[model samples]
Target chain A: METRDALLEAGAALLREQPVGAVLTQVKAQPVAQRAGRTIGAFYHHWSSQEAYHRDLLAYVLDPQRLLSTAAAADTVLADLPRGLPLEEVVRRAARRNFEIVRANPYVPLILALWGKQAQDERVRELLRAHYRSVTDRLVPVYRTLFDAYGLTMRPPYTVEMFAATLTALVEGLTVRAAVEPEVVPLDLPHAGDLSAAPGAGAAGAAPWDLFSATVVGILRAMTMPADPA
Target chain B: METRDALLEAGAALLREQPVGAVLTQVKAQPVAQRAGRTIGAFYHHWSSQEAYHRDLLAYVLDPQRLLSTAAAADTVLADLPRGLPLEEVVRRAARRNFEIVRANPYVPLILALWGKQAQDERVRELLRAHYRSVTDRLVPVYRTLFDAYGLTMRPPYTVEMFAATLTALVEGLTVRAAVEPEVVPLDLPHAGDLSAAPGAGAAGAAPWDLFSATVVGILRAMTMPADPA
Candidate 1:
């Protein structure tokens, strides 16, 4: 790998374990350079300062393309659902796929660590804001397609934008909860066939991922179903 | 006022502006004592160490009784809903009340600031966990009452516990979002009478709190409705 790529890779790996602030202060340039098998000079050669390196790191980790690529498999899974599948089933599949994506890509800890810095760092805040907007823009259409598939209209007082926003917030929020309160927010995915027959069964024993998926799908269904005209 | 109480008050006020870690190192005990108009001796007289002071501050701010008392007015608003009110209306009222409570007693920033310390501080983590449990415990029965009033059974595959958990997660998640992304997660509470006629009115220009309240009510209604057998 190129020297710059190596440093980026090393920084990303280190950040996953320790926060950027801690890494910058405690480890400094030697450890990251050593981890990359490059000298401290090489580290400074590519980046002007620690803050600059952090900016690039934030950009690299949160790059829209990288996130979309990581999520591509899940997108494919959602796209391949049978046309005749119930909307609920489609939503369930989507939620499961999303949970699986988060589990495999495990970025919550890094994000939470960075979030603390957001209060002081404009670049960090901007990067996160852009990432959020990008994710929502990509997913809103997917949600619209699912709603269209069932001929279900979201009840008045709600819109596709609102749905996307709430869904994103829920997923992100739950991800944070799972990180800090793992017992409260498990990530295990359960067999779909078992959901209706034993709802509380999973509550007692299902992994956090399973509960998360179920909750997301349930909220989607609840949010999109046409309101009854009493 | 007692010296200890004055110090706690001073610490709480400082924390609202800066994190505990920063305050401990950057300003130290003298600043806090100065802020409280007490001498450094008085600061030590009440507390042995910075960590000890932090614990007391956490206890002081997150005192369950204080939280409950602050929330009592909102609870009364929810409890007094007319029996004849529609389930949807009841949910809307409840959402509005919850939002109002959060708005009246803003704590998301404090909670988020404290959350970063949880990994190292067992007491902080335990305090948060207990707070979550207390809030959930207090709200679950109220949800049951709302469900009963409507003669609506939460479909299988969903339990009161799950409902409470998901609802709490969504509210807390959105609250955080509103704090960080005010433009994205508006908290405007629309005039209840204008919802149907002015669905897009809020979108066009309602305050963020209104939008937040509507989103929460909509999610609650969606989550609690009986499942369709189709």
Candidate 2:
């Protein structure tokens, strides 16, 4: 690759150990030199500013390729679920796969913490949007496909749309919470409840990922069914 | 009010006009001094540090009282819904009232930004948790009542829990978006489909409200119902 790529890799390594904010200080700026065995000017030669480099670092960590790979892996495995297999198992497996992929990339959460909400640069914003949307696109279809297997009635684009939006929103969000508030719940997905049975019911578990995934699945299950007069 | 109260209120007002990160430097600190006619040490004497003061300022903005008041107002209106008025109208009207309430509290978003993710102080974190839960208590019931009213099941506590966790997470996140990326929809609650119809579907034509109330109601609408599947 290029000179910039090497610097970003160095930065990403630093970011994995500490938040990007920690790296921006004057004192920390010195370490970049030691790491590269060069001066600040040399680091700045290709990247415009430290902030821009951080953004780029996030891009490299959250590359669409990584996300799509995880997504495709989950999708292909889920697609092969035998009609004999319970719907709950398929949903649980897929949810677990998604959670594990996100967990592997701790830098993904850090990058999102700093940039997913706002980036002044158009390119940065576009990159954040594209990366986020790609994940949603993959999950949305998976949810839709699962609903079909259950022989349940589902809503139109809105059902898929809201589910898609919430999933992306929640996963990105829960990652942040896990990093900051580990005590709230360990980041793990729950796998329970018979999918073909009570769609609204969830599996019992302490892992946040499980609970979160189960909850999303439960919500999807409920949405597939029409309004009930309790 | 106590001296502490005065300081907090002053800080909140000052924060509205500019970034809290910049508050100590030139603009507001001087204005606060001029108005109080008190010296810098006088204020510092009451607090642990400037950072502490800002943390307290955030606490005041996110005070449980304010959150409860909003939640209470929404609930009072919610209780009235099962009365003579039509359910659909009640939903629309409730959404409107909530929009207005959230728009009124300009400091909500500011306070959220000030809190960031990893609060250094225990009190601030507890304060934020309490403040968010206040809404969850009121809003969760509203969701339960609605879904139960029609016998339409939601994800129950998971939905409620997710609603609370994700709502605050989105706030921390979207505020950053507003500053640099006002156009990217973090929760898209404002632009979601009409709450009266599809609850979670973000509709356009949303009127702005105080940050807290809008977000509370926004999450309520966003989490309570799922979009239709195609």
Give the top-scoring candidate (TM-score): 1
Which ranges of candidate 2 are over 4 A from the true structure?
A1-28, A35-41, A48-84, A97-124, A140-154, A157-159, A173-209, A222-230, B1-49, B66-73, B76-79, B85-124, B138-230
Model 2 chain A scores worst on lDDT over the 10 consecutive residues at: A18-27
Full-model lDDT for every candidate:
0.53, 0.46
Q: Each predicted complex: what DockQ?
A: 0.09, 0.07
Please give, for residues A203-227, the per-residue lDDT of candidate 1 as tens digits: 4433333555666554454445443
Per-residue C-alpha lDDT of model 2 across residues B35-129, encoded as one tens digit per residue? 45555555556555545554444445566666533574467656765675434344445644554454344444333333343334466457656
State the DockQ, from 0 to 1, for candidate 1: 0.09
lDDT of 2 at A155: 41
lDDT of 1 by residue, B24-136 (tens): 12224554565555566766676688666645556554556546422653475466666555444555556656655664443444455455556556887788777766766
lDDT of 1: 0.53
Worst 10 residues of 2 chain B by lDDT: B18-27
- Distance from true position, residue B148, model 2, in Å? 8.4
| Tens digit of per-residue lDDT, candidate 2, span A1-230 | 33323322332232223222321112223344444455566556645665655444445544677564356545654675664455555555565666566645534433443352233346656766676667556666666666667675544323564555544545555554544454443344333322324454333223334644554554455345543324
Grade the docking of candidate 2: incorrect
Interface RMSD of 1: 16.5
